[model samples]
Target: MSKLIIGRYIPGDGPVYRMDPRGKLLATFIFIAIVFLANNWQTYAIACGFCLLAVIATKLPLKTFLQGIRPLVWLILFTALLQLVFTTGGHVYWHWGIFSITSFGLVNSIFIFLRFLMVILISTVLTLTTMPLEIAAGMESLLKPLKYLHVPVEQIALVMAIALRFVPTLMDQTVKIMNAQRTRGVDFNEGGLIQRAKAFVPIIVPLFIESLNVALDLSIAMEARGYQDDKPRSRYRSLHWSHYDLYNLGFFVLLTVLLIIFREH
Candidate 1:
């Protein structure tokens, strides 16, 4: 759990880290589209290769990237198993009532699993490289046009930023609470499904209380600071697009075009 990398930002001087947050967000969106465009093994392989190049460019430790996906292993496996057991069309190698594994099912399962992994990796790279504030600012900039539609863009951005900023904090708090519970004779790992869930009740209740307290405190702080959505705010650091951003965006755009052209429908 300590090794979980989701929603945690690591400060770095890599090219990816220096690119504009908006560019990163756009690239991630495009990459997701590209992933879904993949159909056959060749396209999936290309997608995997693109993700590999991205992971390498981030300059983060391979172990760190792997840790980000570790928690999702079971989810990926479950999805793959569902695809394998349900999908039917190709040659069937085994059959047991409604559970039959066909060649098409196997292929689809493999591709789906790879797709899940690649998507996770790409998203992890974005969070690891960008700070919460940058994310909020980027989102706000991207959604500025929505303000004309009477959308509360700033408030929405603030809410998103705060939620992301608290992820690591909450994870750390959960870990601390779990340890405290363990000291009080709670065994989280040594139990059946229902038993383990019951064990977590003690942990969850206290965590909820703590979260409430934190939220209350934050609300008080914001009130003390006179935070208002209707007021104009000044930024400490403004975002500017550099040549690096252009290069990064261009590379992804070119990659997307190439993927589209070669992707098997």
Candidate 2:
């Protein structure tokens, strides 16, 4: 969980960090869509190249980006393994009892791994660069139109922002609880899968209780501050679109068009 950087923000002066939060959010959405549009090596390569460029532009330490990917290593491997074993097409390479490997399977597995990694990396970049408040404000601004339809945009944004903000806090809490459990002779690492899962019960129970307490405290604090869903709130910092935002949006649009033109069906 320490390696999980999904909700943690790193302070940086890079272009990515300086870009408007709304633009970053929109670009991330478009990038996710473009990832699905990639169906072949060429398209994957192009997408990955762009991601690498973005990573470099962030000027963050290479290790930080790698740490973000480390937690998903197992999931990536499992996905690749599934693709290799189940996908059947192209030239047959080898076959065994209920298992076979083919050239297409090999290629497909590689692409799938790359696709997942690319998406994760892009998302990591967004969170690492943008603050939780900025993300919430951006989301609220983007979803503001939904208010005409009676959607609770502010409440939805608040929930999302709170959830994101608590991830690191919860991770820290889990670690502390695990340490406490270890002191009580609970062994989490020395058992089979089921036993290890069972050992986590102590941690999970307390974590859940602690999370509820935190939520209750937050509710009280908000009430003390007179926060209301129906109240008109003003921000000390408002989002301003700059030329850089326009350039970023334009680049993503061009990228989407190129990917659509080059992607294989």
lDDT of 1 at 141: 89
| TM-scores of all candidate predictions against the true structure | 0.81, 0.83
Q: Tell me how candidate 1 scores on lDDT.
A: 0.89
Writing each residue's lDDT as its tens digit, candidate 2 over 1-265 gives: 4556876799999888889999999999999987899888788888998899889878999899888888889999999999998888888888887678999899999999999999898889899999988988898999899999999998898789788878879989999999999999999898799999999889989999999999999999988999988988887769999987887788888888878889876
Report the number of backbone clashes for model 2: 0
Task: Report the C-alpha lDDT of model 1 over 52-131, residue by residue, as the tens digit.
Answer: 98888888899989889889999999999999999998999999999999999999999999999998998998999999
Backbone clashes in model 1: 0
Which pairs, if any, clash in model 1? none
* lDDT of model 2, residue 30: 92
Worst lDDT run of 10 residues, candidate 1, spans: 1-10
The TM-score, computed over Cα atoms with residue i paired to residue i, of candidate 1 is 0.81
Instruction: Report RMSD (Å) for each prediction in the order shown.
Output: 3.2, 3.0
Best by TM-score: 2
TM-score of predicted structure 2: 0.83
